[model samples]
Each structure stands twice: as C-alpha cells, then as structure tokens.
Target: MNAKIVDQHVECYVRSLLPEHTGLLKVLEQFAKLHNVPIIHPEIAQYMSVLLEIAKPTRILEIGTAIGYSASVFASHMKRGHIDTIELNAIMAEKARETFEDLNKSVPEVSLSIHLGDAKDVIKTLEGPYDMIFIDAAKGHYQTFFETAYDLLSKNGIIVSDNVLYKGMVATDDYIVKRKITIVKRMRKYLEFITTHPNLETTVLTMGDGLAISYKKGILNE
Candidate 1:
C-alpha cells in the first residue's frame, strides 16, 4: 500500500494495515486508528474495494464495523448505495459513529447506519434483501453468519466471508490442538457446505488470509 499513506503507516506502526487511501480512504483510516479501531489488513481492504465496485450492491450488510475502515472503503466505492454495519463492541460502535459523522458531512454520496448488538441477533431484526452481505465479525460465528446471510440476501446475491484461514492454522494437524481449531474447522465445514450447496456457487480464493465468496441464485427460502 505504498500508494496510500494509511497503508504505509498502519503497516509500519500497527502491522495490521489494510489497503486504503486518503481524500476519502485516509479520512476513515485516521478515525479508525485514532479510536484504536481494529481494521482489516491493507491488501484485503484493497481487494474488498474492487469486489464492492464489481458487485455494486444496493444494500450491503456488514457483520462487523471495527472502526469503520472497511465500511469506509465500501462506502467510497458504492457509487449510489448505503451501508448497514453491525458492531457489537460499544467502543467500536462509538468510534464508528465518529467516523460516520465526519463522512456524512463531506461525502454525501454514501450513507451509513449502525446496528448496535450481536450480529446474529441484529441480523434477525433486519428485513432482508441485502444485495451483498459481508461476514467479518467473530471468528467462531462464521457458520451461523452464513445461515443468517442466506436468509437475508436477495436473489442472485453474494456473500463474502473473511479470515477463514486464521493465519494458516486450519492446515495444522488435529493433534496440535490449536486454540482456534474448533472454530476454524467449523468455518471450513461451513465453506464446504456452501460450495457444495445446490443453490449457491462458491469459490474460495487464496487472497489475503482467505476469502470465501458465495453467490446465491433464485429465491427458495421458506
């Protein structure tokens, strides 16, 4: 992310840098770091930007809104849509509010709303039809998030899940007993179930800690 100051600094300083920029990208990143917002890696954020641009979803439901860095990225690329972000951490929710307040005044093209509660519970209150769903919250709740996303997404919609690899821990032997093994294994199981499902077609790509993209066809949920 040498192209962007946020990338360079977050990498050098926090080591959890994500692909972002200024003008718009930087403004959000600054607020995130300023509030100690836990954001995604730079490379992943860049990739996510492209994904959002390509999909251009009218309604996007983001499971996690840590300081709003990624949400900002999506907001910047979403030419005509708004973002619905869920942040369970009160500190993070408050930080994201600051970031949104700053953006709402300057960047009028995008609007952001926050759901303050657990993603799964908050998701139930949401009435659907989100064209895009981003699952990036707790590592252990991936499976449940999948089920919820399926129920919320519109027809021919797409869902993106992050951090499936957990820093390559999923590949280790079972006997090793990794701290996050159970969750990681469950994530893998969820991935397999989604990829093999008849209604949804999924392709897990090896991009920046692994991202699983699932595309759902038609409306079959009852």
Candidate 2:
C-alpha cells in the first residue's frame, strides 16, 4: 500500500524527526490503524499544520472528518479558527465529536462543529467564505467537492486535497488494477482539471499518497 515517492526507510526516518504526539491523537492513530480507517499520515498532518500556521485561516471547512484527526490538527494549529467538518457515517461522526470534545478540554478556544450527513448534501447548505477548505473525503467526488467548495472559498483562500495521487496510480498505469481503475481515472481527471484550471494555481506534492494545494488565482493582488 505504500506507493509514494519516498522509500519506506526514508519515510520512516523523516517521520522519526517529527516530535512525538502523546495526546488523544496518538490514541486515535492507533485505533484508526487497527480498524483500517484511512487517516492522513502523520507527516501529512504536520504539513497541514504548517499550512495553517502560514495561512492563519480563521474559518476552515473540512469535507471528511474521519474520526476528527485532521480536524483536531487544524484546530490545534490555528490560533483562532472554527472548523466545520462533514462525515456521512453516523458512528464515525459521533466518535469525531467525542474526540473534539476531549480535545476541547485542553484547547477550549478552538471551535469544531460536526455535520452528520452526505457531504454532497451538506455542501449545498453551507453558506461559507472559509479561508481554507480541506478535502479528504470520497476520492471519486473530489471534482464535485472542489466545484461546490469554490464558491464558498474566501478571497486568497487555499484548497488542500489529500490522496490526490491515489497511491501513485494516477501518475502511471503500472500500479493499476481492475477494481481501482475507475477511481484512478477519476483522480487523474481531477488532477488535470485542477492543474489546468484558469482560476487556480495548483501544485501536487508527492507526499503521503499526494497532496494537491491549489490557490485561487488572482487573490494575491487584491
């Protein structure tokens, strides 16, 4: 399952350099692995936190709240920010809510709101001008998510899409299999659109799976 730019040893070495997390995050990470829930890699989460620090986004919208790990990361990094995370699975949503509550005990200033429902439907109801939008949900619907999230993005906003490389399959057909062809094709198409879109300046980092960071063009001069 490790189809990334860095080899396993290098990845491990890099991760070793990161500070240890002894909080609920460590517990969540362990639980997610045991249950096979796809959570962002620790290095990826660290990168996201760095992005949050630089952007200093006050309002963040996360499309997937899978147990609230990334949401918690975002909240902890931002000095002042509110997160609105969506999760389709009720059980996962409940667990994420609990995690947020637990995290709140320490960082009471960070605000996190969980929306339980299909992200597509939830996207329709959101009236947002969020400073940052993090998409880590259904890989197949990334294009739709980006389209819906575009209108909600504030000026100078940033959109971060995780798992864009799809295990390096999107870059080349060598790793492709019959069952995953559809997702690979869709992810490739999504990458093409984001990279070539007239209004977006997108860069795909060959990190965990891959992370696509897109900035709405023309926001800097304004």
Candidate 3:
C-alpha cells in the first residue's frame, strides 16, 4: 500500500529539490531506508529546520524517538537547547542514545535525552514548560498524548502533530483499510478537537503525510 498522503509525483519533485542531507542526517536517512525504519520525511525535516530557526525554542519535547532521527534534527538546528524524547521500545531507545551521543560530539550545545517508556506514562512524569512539543508517535494514541502533554507546554508553545492524515485515510473513508478504521476514527476526532478547542489555534497542512500545527492561544499576545 502506498502510504503517502501527498501526490507521489509532487512529493518526489519537492524532495528532489531539497538540498542533499549531509553528515549524521544523511547516514540516518540511508539507515532508515535500508532498515525500513520510519523517520520523518525529508520534506518534513526541512520544514522543521525552518520552523526551529524561527521559533528558537529553548526546550523541546518529542513524543517519538525512533533511532533519534527527528530529535537529532531538532538538536542540530538549535544553537543551545535541551530535548527530551520518548521511545517506547528499549532497543530503539538504546539506538537513540547512540545517536544522541554522536550528536553531542558534533553539536555539543544541545542536550538530548532519551526516556524509555510508553509516551502516555512518561509524559505524566515530566515537569515541563516546553517551548515546543513534537508528536510523531503511535497513530491511535495522538489525542491521549496531546491531552496528557497539554499542561507541560509553555504559554506560547506549539504542538506539531505528524502523520495526522494517516496516508490520506483520516481525510476520507475511501482510503481507510479495514484494520485502520479505528485509527482513522481516532485521528479524525483528534483533528476535530485540536481545530475547535477554544484554547488552540490550529492549521492543518497537507505537507508530508500531514502536519497539524496548534498554538496555545490564551497567552500569545500577552
């Protein structure tokens, strides 16, 4: 099944135009491709790099740390910051640790820590006023993750949810497979909540897969 939410040709063209990934990011991209590990799309990574530059977040909380690819991206872009990333699988967490260790050598200013546990459980244990929260974990549990992490966000913080379109499945019933029905439904509900909540102002972009960027509204002007 083609799990791309964007049109294949358009995605390909956009990716082709992106500057080549270098150093650790290049290596990790190759590794993810060869090993069939899921990481953020190159386009998403590029977009995130721009977002990081503009936001200049000092503290970031990442819900998924697969091979630490996205977390590495976040770390590299920051001049000085700390990242707390959660990975559910122990092996993946260990792998992420190695990635962070290497990243430290090159980008020593940013601190990256991998917390090994279910995101739902680990998020509760965190004391945070994070400048940004990036969610790219289990598809079905996004709402739970968002709700659980809401209090941890800093006043002007943003939450970026990835793969919300779920390969276009969440956009319509036509793309949903039988086994993914529950996930699609949940994703729809999550989207609805984020879009309509009075405390949030969200913009859903049909970029890589999909990205729902929600800003905490109550304190932005103050």
Candidate 4:
C-alpha cells in the first residue's frame, strides 16, 4: 500500500540524510524490496533506534516478525536483552529463525525467540513485564493485540504501534477506498481508545505511514 503520509520530497530527503544499512540488515532491506515483503520503513527504523537507545530496554515483545528485520534492528541497539517475537506465517517464521541465527553470531549478547502462532492466542500465553512492546501485525486486529498485551508491559515500558494511520485512510474519508473502509474505521477506533484512555499518554506521529507511541501514566508516576 503506497500511502504518502509525508511529502515525497521530504521523506526522500530525510532518508537520504540517514546512514546506509550494512551487513545483514543491508541484505534484508534489499531482499524485502526484491520480494515485496512488508518491513519497517528505513526512517521508522532509524527513529526506533534512537528510542531504543534511550529506553535501554532489557526485554522486548514484538507482535510481528517479518523476515526478522525489525527484531534484528532491536537486537543491535540492545547491549544485552531478550526479544520474544511472534509470527503468524509459518514460512516467515522459518525465515526469521534463520535471520535470528545469523544475528546470534553477530550479537551474542541479545537473545531472540520466535513464537509461531496467531498473536491473539500467543499473547495470552506470554508472561508480563516486558520493557517494550512493538505492534506491527494485522492492522484490523491492532486493538485486540494491544488490549491483550497491555498487562504484559512493564510499568515504565512503552508500546509502539506501526502503520496506525493506515496509508492516510484513517485520517480522512477522502483517501479511503471502499475495500479498506472497515480497516480504516477500526484503526480510527483504536487510535481514539489509545489517545483518550486515562491510563495512557499516546502520540501519533505522521511519519512512515503512521506510528503511535504510548506509555502508561499513573503506575509510572507512582
């Protein structure tokens, strides 16, 4: 889905200014482009790198494991951390395992576990207190994923939701296609809940389709 949330010129300029991806990340980026696999945008990756650096999370829970690109990126920023990632597609899960194996060789300090199953079911089986939670799976089920995983997050942890704006369709009806109407509506509902929830403070950024970063309020302050 080609959704130009940010201006094309500005996005390109921002990407141009960032450093190139090297090693396995470089290969994965190229492979994703060639195979048409949906991975995090380069700009989003860079933004997350900075956030991860600041958060310095010891445990991360990733809802989507697409070829392990984002998980690998998370591993690189971590000094010594564990990432538990879920993948629904069996083929993609195997591919992620291979990528994790390679990542192990490079960053032995970080460990990764790929859980193959529907996130809705897998999330319930997971234990709590993860330092960070990343949601990047099926768009329509984002609210379901977040609500189920909410208690799994640590007190000060943050939840990052990718593609929340959904190619700009969630923002306005003018950009909505008939086929995407349901998804757009669901996305709008999810955004409203997160933004208005008394327990959370959320900010939706317009970059990279749309990224919503949320953090719990009371417990953290307490």
TM-scores vs. true structure, each candidate = 0.83, 0.95, 0.96, 0.97
Off-target runs (Cα >4 Å) in candidate 3 are 1-3, 219-222
**Tens-digit lDDT track of model 3 for 8-103:** 899999999998879998999998999899999889999999999999999999999999999999988899989999999998888889888889
What does candidate 4's lDDT look like per residue over 90-189, in tens digits?
9999999999999999999999999999999999999878999999999999999999999898876899999998889998888898998899999999
Q: Kindly report which residue stretches of model 1 are placed more than 4 angstroms away from their true locations once superposed.
A: 1-20, 27-37, 174-177, 219-222
The best candidate by TM-score is: 4
Q: Which ten residues in a row have the lowest lDDT in candidate 1?
A: 1-10
lDDT of each: 0.77, 0.88, 0.92, 0.93
Error of 2 at 93 (Å): 0.4
Ranking by TM-score: 4, 3, 2, 1
TM-score of 1: 0.83
Clashing pairs in 3: none
TM-score, prediction 2: 0.95
A best-first ranking of the candidates according to their lDDT comes to 4, 3, 2, 1
Top-lDDT candidate index: 4
> Where does candidate 1 clash, by residue pair?
17-42, 18-41, 18-42, 19-42, 21-26, 22-26
Query: What would the per-residue lDDT of candidate 1 be over residues 69-175, giving only the tens digit for each residue?
Result: 78877877777777899999898888788888877766678889999999988888888889999989998888888787677888889998887665555545543
RMSD of 2: 2.0
